[model samples]
Structure formats: C-alpha cells, structure tokens
Target: MNAIELSHVSTAKPVLLGDSLTELEVMRDVSLSVPEGEILALIGPSGSGKSTLLRMINRMEDPTSGRIFLFGSDIANLDVKELRRRVGMVSQTPALLPGDVADNIAYGPNLRGEPCNPGDYLEHVGLERELLRRPASALSVGQQQRMCIARALANHPDVLLLDEPTSALDRTASRNIVELILRLNEKLGLTVIIVTHVMEHAQALATRVAMLVGGSLIEQGPAVDFFESPATETGRKFLRGELAEDGR
Candidate 1:
C-alpha cells in the first residue's frame, strides 16, 4: 500500500500588486504516491514548489484544493497533532528549543506525559549519548541537524519529511546525513520524502526521483532512469543546469 498519496492537490495564494489582486499558483494539480519504506527525492529549480509540495504531505501547508492521504486515511480528517506525530518533519535548519539536548529530544513525548530516553534516539542518529546534557546551541551545525533527526524519531513516526536537510552542511556533514537517513530507513522501515537542491545527494539517497518545473510535475521514475535518460526536455535541461536558478 502507498504510505502517502496526494490526489489532484493544488495550492494558491492571493497576492496584491499595485492595488491589483492576483492568485499565485504554488502547486498545480499534482498527484504522487510514495510506497512504504521507499526514499523518494523531490527535485526542481528554485520556486518550483518542491518544498511547498513536501510541506503539504504533513499539512504544514494545506492545499487550496484536493486531498492528501496517509496510510489510506484522509489527513484532513485526522487530528492535527496526531497527524504531525505520525509524520515527522525536519527542516533545512535545525530549530532546537532553548534547552539542553535531552530536553529538546524529550519535548514531543513530554507533551503527552510519556517517558523518553534520549540516549536511544541519539544512537539512532549516530550521536553519542555523552552529549545529552550539552547545550543545544553549543553543538556544531552537523550535530544539531542530527539532533533534530533524533528529536523527530522520538515520535516514532511512520513517514519522515525532510526539506533541504543538507543544504547548510559541509560536504562531509552532508554525506554523513545521507548515510544516516539510509540507515534509519533500513532499520525502521520509514517512508521518506526529501526535497533537495543537490543532485549528488539525491543520487545517493533516493530510490526514485520526481522533478517539478514551474510548479508542475514534469517527470518521475526510477532513480537510474531519471538520471541517465530523463523523459522530458525540461528534465534534461535541469540536469544540465540550463534552467535559471536550477536546483536551489
């Protein structure tokens, strides 16, 4: 069964320019499916709505029209907090709370009066347990990102949504994060949807690739086929960096 599905989803925002009102379409009738335990990379040029599309899966941004399903259930019908707990999200930058590492990791479960052992989650993200008491701000950017992943994992989510997860990291840190994501998916059978501007990261992490251009899905297929023999001219142009602000 598909872990997540977007059926005829579209989003638009009203914009006012010089006293004239206009509707800006962010996504246009997009339909996509992600199977269980699969890593699907969402790629496109800047302003192509890749991030917007990812955010919609978790209802961080709701679509103006259409529906989203999680494990065959309509997400709109689910309680928002429960939905978020089931679908964890990690943004480009780690937004840690103003506390030590352990506090940040325990925040989610604490809200529900549940117990959380921070060390176990830290191990999942390849972080040492000794840092549990360290201040969140003291950790390096890479460590902070890993901590964010750990915090999300503490929720025991079925699906993980990552938006530009490695954009701010160095090459070494980025590669570490990619490996960590692969490990989590393998170990926990987590379905992952990642939006990335780096082709190399997508190539290394994604089992399938989906490309959006001008807020529309242009092509999507197995990773090997999409990388080597893209079906559309726009996809090819994106690979060759022909599109303006490509892969941002």
Candidate 2:
C-alpha cells in the first residue's frame, strides 16, 4: 500500500476573517501517492502551498475538501493524536522547549508512559551523550535541529515529514542532516517525505520529485527523468531557474 495518498485534496481559509470572509484557496485538487520506504521530495516556489500540503498528511490542518489516506486508512476517521504519532514531523525552525536536550527528546514518549532514555536517542540522531543535560538554547542550530528529529522519533513513527530541515544550517551541517536522513531511510526502512527548495539536495536524496507550483502539483516522476526532461512546462522552467513564483 502507498504510505500516504492525497486524493483531490484542497485547502481554503478566510482571507479576511471578520469583515470580508473571502475564501483564499491555498491548495487546489492536490493528488499524489508516496510509496512505502520511498524518499519523495516535494519542491515548489513560495506561496505554492508545499508546507500546507505536508501539514495535511499529519493532519496539522484538515483539508477543506477531498480525502487523505495513510496506508490505505482514511486520516479523517483516525484519531488526530494517533495520526500525528504515526507521521512524525521535523520543522524548518525547530522549537526547543524550556529545558535540556533530554527533556525535549523524552516529551512524546513520556506522554505515552513509555520509558525514554535520552542517551540512546541522542546517539540515534548522531549527538553525543554528554550534551544530554545541556541547555537547549546553548546548543548550536544544527544540534538543536537534531534534537528535534530525535524528539519526533520518540513517537516511533512509520513516516517522517521534514520541511526545509537543512535550510538554516551551514553547508557541513546541512550535509550531516542529509546523510543522516538517507541512513535512517536505508537502515530502518522509514518512509520520508521531505520538502526542500534546494534542487541539488533533492536530487541527491530523493528517488522521485514532485513539483508543486501555484498550489497545484504540476508534475512528479523519477528524479532523473523529472530533472532531465520534466513533463510539464512549469517544471521545465523551474529546473532552469525560471519558475514564476519567488522565495525558496
């Protein structure tokens, strides 16, 4: 079964809540399928609703119309808390709570009454055990981001969603996270759906690339074919560094 599937998914919200109340459609009829254990990259220009699409998989925000399935089960019918546990997310700017690294990593598992050893997970995300008691604010941005990944993994998720995970790090740090992602996918058979603006990075890590433009999925295919000769005009322009929308 496909790990995650979106069928005619759409999202709209009030442009002006109190006075105007005009509905602004952020995503329009987005349909895509991600196979189990596949690292699929979601690429798009700014305001293209890529993050919005990612949020829907974990039900961060419900779709205004259409349906989403996680491993053949409708997300709407599943409990929101359980869905989020199964679909872990690591954000672009990770929010480290008012505590040490260990506290952050143990949050989810502790909530579920599961025993969580910070050292084990620290190693799991490539961090040293000595940093367990260090203040979260004291850590570098890269280390904090790794903590976020570890925190997400505490839930023992089947799929991991990463949104611009390496955008803020230096080249070396970015490469660290990239390699770690690939390793986790290979070793654990984890399904990863990563949102990235770096075309080269996507090409390096993803087997397939899905292009989202103007809140719509323009094209998606094998990474080589999609980058070599994109089926859609928008995709072709995007690869040539000429897509209309702005921002990474």
Candidate 3:
C-alpha cells in the first residue's frame, strides 16, 4: 500500500494589496504517491513549493482542493495529533527545546502520557548516551540535527518528512546525515520524503526522484533513470545547471 498519496492536490493563498486581492498559487494539481518503505527525494528550483508539499502530508498546511491519504486512509479523517504522530517532520535547522537533550527527546511521549528513554532514541540516531544529559544547545550543528531526528523518532513515527536536512552542514556532516538516513530506512523500514536542492545528495540517497518546477511536478522516476535521462525539457535544463541559480 502507498504510505502517502496526493490526488489532484492544489494550494493557493490570497494576497491583498490595498483594496485588491490576488490569489497566489503555491502548488497546482500535484498528484503523487510514496510507496511504503520508499525513500523519495523531492528536487526543485526555489519557489517550486517542495516544502509546502511536504507540509501538506502532515497537515501543517492544508490543500485548498483535493485530498491526501496516509496508508489508505484519508488524513483529513484522522485526529490532528494522531496524524502528526504518524508523520514526523524535521526542518533545515534544528528546533531543539531549551533544555538538556534528554528532555527534548522525551517531550513528545510525555505529552501523550507514555514512557520514553532518551538514550534509546539517541542510539537510534547514533548519538552517545552520555550526551543525553548535556544541554541541547551545546552540541555541534550536526549533532543537534541528529538529536532532532532522535526527538522525532521518540514519537514512533512511521514516516519522516525532511526539508533541506543537510543544507546547513559541511560536506563531511552532510555525508554523515545521508548515511544515517539510509541506515534508518534499511533498519526500520520507515517511509521517507526528503526535500533537497543538492543533486549529489539526492542521487546518493533517493531510490526514486521527483522534480518540480514552477509549482508543478515535471518529472518523476527511478533515481538512476531520471539522473541519466530526464523526460522533460525543464528537467534536462535543471540537470545541466541552466536552472541551478534558482535552486536553494
């Protein structure tokens, strides 16, 4: 079964200037599916609504039209907190709470009146157990990112949505994160949808790739096939660096 599915989804927001109102289209008729336990990468130029698309899956942003489903059930029918617990999201920057790593990791479960051992979650993300007591802010950017992942994992999510996860890291740190993502997918069978502008990272981590341009899905296919020969002109130009300037 598909882990997540979007059918004719579209989003638009109204903008007002003086007495006039204009609608800004964020995504246009985006239909896509992510199979169970698949790692799908979303690539696009800036302003293509990749992050917005990710947010819609977890209802952080609702679509103006059409529907979204998770594991064969309409997400709209699920409780908001339950839906979020099933789909966890991590942003480009770590949004660690102001406290020790242990508290941050336990925050999610505590809200639901469940037990959580920070060290166990930390280990899932490859962090040392000793770091659990340390201030969350004391860790390096990469470590903080891993801690964020651990915190998300504490909720026992089945799917993970990552938006520009490695954008702020150095080459080494980025590589580590890529490896970690691969490990999590292989070990836990978690479905993942990651938004990234880095072609190399996408090529390395994604089994399937989806490309968006101007808020429309232009091409999507196996990573190897799409990288070797894109089906669309815009996708080809994007690969040739013609649209690189517009990428984040």
- List, residue by residue over 1-248, the lDDT tens digit for candidate 3: 99999899999978796899998898889999999999999998888889999999999989999899999999999999999999999999989897899999998899999999999989999899999999999999999999999998999999999999998889999999999999999999999999998999899989889998777888988889999999988888898878753443
Cα RMSD (angstroms) for every candidate in the order listed: 1.8, 2.0, 2.0
Count of clashing residue pairs in every prediction:
0, 0, 0
Q: Per-residue lDDT of 1-248 in model 2, one digit per residue for the tens?
A: 79999999999977887886798899989899999999999998988999999999999998999999999999999999999999999999978887899999999888889899888878988999999999998999999999999888888899999999999899999999999999989988889999998987898999888988878888987888997899987787888888778423
Alpha-carbon TM-score of each model against the true structure: 0.96, 0.96, 0.95
Tell me the lDDT of model 3 at 226. Answer: 94
lDDT score, residue 101, model 1? Answer: 99
lDDT of each: 0.92, 0.90, 0.91
TM-score between candidate 2 and the true structure? 0.96
Estimate the lDDT of model 2: 0.90
Q: List the residue pairs that clash in candidate 1.
A: none
- Residue 136, candidate 2: Cα error in Å is 1.1
Better of 1 and 3 by TM-score: 1
